[model samples]
Target: MKENANSALKIVASFVFVFAIVGVLYVVYFNSNGQPSTDVPVGVKTFGSCSAMSSFIKTNAQKSYPSYWGSGVVRAFTGVTGAISASPSMAEGGKATDYSTTNIQVAGVDEADITKNDGKYIYTLSGDKVVIIDAYPAESAAVLSEIAFNSSTERVTEMFVNGDKLVLFGDKTDYNGPIMGAEISYRPYYYRTSSFVKIYDIVDRSNPILTRDVAIDGNYYSSRMIGDYVYVVLNSYVYEDIVMPNITAGGVETPVAGCADVQYFEDVVDSSYSLTTIMSINVNTEEMSEKVFLTGNTQTMYVSTDNIYLTSTQYYYEPMPLVGDFFPRSEEKTLIKRVGINGNTVEFKAEGSVPGWILNQFSMDEYNGNFRIATTSGHVSRSGGGSSNNVYVLNGSLDTIGTLEDLAPGEQIYSARFLGDRAYLVTFKKIDPLFAIDLSDPTNPNVLGKLKIPGYSSYLHPYDETHLIGIGKNAIEAEEGDFAWYQGVKLSLFDVSDVANPKEMSMVSIGERGTDSYALNDHKAFLFDKEKGLLVVPILLAEFDAEPQSDWDYGEYTFQGAYVYSVDLTSGFTYKGRITHVTDDSLLKSGYYYESPYSVKRSLYMDNTLYTISEKTVKANSLIDLSELANVSLPYEGSDYYYGYYGV
Candidate 1:
């Protein structure tokens, strides 16, 4: 009986050994095939790297081997699964030029006007030069004779064309020499001595003669023409002169002479700089009329049929008070008012009373005959700044229609456009989600959908009701010797047919990293005819190179030509060529070049032309033919600064 029991035990032990051997073989085979093994379990470590080990063998030596076997196995499995789930490749297509060279001319380009007149001629303001281009046979869109102001220093601030008559508001600046003993080496303070509003008769496209030049007092900042009357906004003090006091050896304040009274314009002092007024001029009769006295600083004005909307922002300045010395306290407010143009009455008003500072710039779009205003407001603390966008839609009478809040958290709204029954708001921070709001019901609007991307978008234009062309920066990689430094602009095409689920079709980066705004012509073909459908992309190339970044200091850069592209709502979008620069030596060398006056930070697009305002030039506009200017290489050739990506 004992011998039989011993034999039974030996048989059981043999069975257990065979089972263990089989388990080991299975684990080895599973691992060899890039699959998870039961016996050899994979585990993640502190470094997030993976390691694998046999369950039966647990040893300190194995733990010290520094093997990433677990990670390798997971990666292998991921690769297999990804291969199985990959989508089919898109069909390859031929590349097409974005823009074709049609006509080139020397004119100051502003975003204010780029509308087609009589369906054949294109009117645009280029500094003191006003150009009318024929847009019929493509080649016919050449610049006719340009009207120039007699003085080389005089410049046109704003312009509008109504049928055959074109009205221009111009301002001239005279230097009062250097502020202090500093000669040409110092920045000169400019004083505007004269302002003029001129009207031109352009019945004949080739020869547009000036009809009247009405003198305007103060600085003519901006103007809009509706019917026979022209509404103008004027300001005597545009900028404040800030002077930081120097500390002496004995801890005494050393006042700098000729500093132009740094605190002269503060509200507490009630200085002359606080005064500004809005006026109206009759183009048909050539008569001047005062409309309203703008108490606060007015930045931009929009004129509709019955009302003129002005965005009024305030400014403040004060000296830092000593330990016990009285400190000057000042606060500024941003208010939007709809004033009656015919009767000169304040119709509607909405003011932001928060303690934080508000930017003077805002975007206005007309939807279903109602006006929509989108402005940014935020709180500024010592640690950081936070802001929110407030969109106010007003009725035809300038009454409040609706409000959309928190569209962008902490980002400023740059531009807004209405497409069909929806409005798209563009923001400054990263490629913001395009908030698609339904304006079908003007009073009670609904956020129908949103389009999100990975980069920043300043301006959005609709190719149709379903597709939008977002102009901004994508990603960029800088090459330094053998190494590469990468950044992104986030320039891309988005399919918004399903607004809720907008898909990023494709995105390409321009040369370096910078902000870009696009100007698109919508009447022409979406994909073909580069000369017909133009997309002007103005890249603030210099801002990418500035240091100690100042909110006000947009780098000094020229209007680096226009980048043209073609868009198709049904299929997709394509990068066309760029408008080639005028090759003629005379035109290239002419002093009448485009300079961006506004800080490079802001994107300006008016009509269908793009404008980049700079402080170096009196005229701040650049007119670009998108269809004909895309794919055209810029003349800049440097290492730190290169041409921005024209198209993606």
Candidate 2:
């Protein structure tokens, strides 16, 4: 939540490769408009026609990239390529106690987050260190083990836990290597980085044994887990003529030793040095496989049960803007590639193109052999100029079947969610327009209903089949024509019981003028359980004496923590309370919202217990009365940890 280096590729036709060991193989194509090109059920397309792919690159890649970027764009997308989870946190164990897993997009696929649970113990990244808490007997909870990153760039960001093994993903800056027999003078100030994956065996609970240390060039783009395999994507730009990777499987291997292990697509050599390598590692067997895509720098990625979608934006260098325009002047197009994931193999599926760019992973969904996507088309412009939003329905081949284009003319998409046969879209300019779209028929998707509300939503999640929860900021119309000033964090519940008429059933705004929450930008921080009727979010509230004079005037910090709410399907929202790790009075008296420096960033439910975590503490509260039952403060002195060293 996250394979080996060798893979068996089964060519479906002449261009597509199906990675399935034993299953149905399909050869899909699209006509001029975007639909199935043929009706063939099985065939082979292993590496695609070299001549046709070259021609496609010549026609599309150059025009797709900006002249400034030069050779960064792909020559022929007419070629092949490769590239989340689809589920919620499931309570797997006993009825009296249920633990939460990572909230994912697909049921079987899991996405790595900051925190992970293995039923009995909860593993979380606290600053640059990881803390494993023995959180079973509510009253006897305590920190089990703590592991800190050894280097500055090795700051742990996310992790995944499966059985007795824990995999941690982090990034580190590149330091100057030894030259001749002596080390280089000093490292550059610029950020030259590498991504690291550390696999640890936590079977002993008290002492975690680091099993594998896999370091890859480039920064971490994204990752996913399906069954026993962990797939990680790293995007790197070639800088020096020589590159070395440090890998520790059986023993420590230098750049020279690991050099021979690096492989690339021989047919497409990336002149731009933009390299994207996807590595799949098996946690159970420790077998690893990698695939490299030249000039395939990923922007947004979506992973399904059987397929992966990689999206890249192509900047089209064009004529100058009219006098005073920056953003509205540029023209761009986005390309999507599909890759097959079977057991330990990842094979190229197909490729397609769309007009503009996508927002995030939430904007794409796979359901009933149809992939539905929402995109904000064109550059943002004054008046509706060329700006508009659209929704497209693509079949298994990724051909456009039905489309609702030029929607909400002047607005761009903020968030989108596709549930089963239904799709929900939120676009904002001055006011938020929540649209409920009916996708019962892929060939004819129409907006069933729309509700206009204040502010906008950045993330959308399903509460039930007919309910949705939105997390964003509350804003008020400003002096400008259609401008708004964003305020505190806003949590809204929408009732979509009637597809023809969706309504905001309950709306709640917390904090003061400049409050913010991690949930607004990161969906993983949001915790919602329908059966438990619980909603929890991390917030940093700020109070303003009056309307601020400028945007930077973030007001005075007041309170920082998590907000607990008992949400009812029909009754709306009921405020439970706020949980904070800060207990310093002198620091709180200084008008700082996050007095403890470390603030609560996430919350999850373990049966009837609610757990809130910060960089230095973990608190458990009863689900019924919200009373603190157990608390464990992490032991890491201020200057001991690279990240927590600041102690500000």
* Candidate 2 C-alpha lDDT tens digits along 208-239: 99988877667887889888889887776432
Candidate 1: tens digits of C-alpha lDDT, residues 476-588: 12222211222333455667778777766766565443323322221111112222344435332333454624322333333343344544543354565443233333332
Instruction: Work out how many backbone clashes candidate 2 has.
Output: 32
Leading candidate by TM-score: 2
Each prediction's RMSD over C-alphas, in Å, is 28.5, 10.4
- CA deviation > 4 Å runs, candidate 2: 1-96, 176-192, 239-248, 251-273, 321-328, 381-386, 544-555, 585-597, 638-648
Report the Cα lDDT for candidate 2.
0.67
* lDDT values, one for every candidate: 0.41, 0.67
Q: What is the lDDT of residue 30 in candidate 1?
A: 15
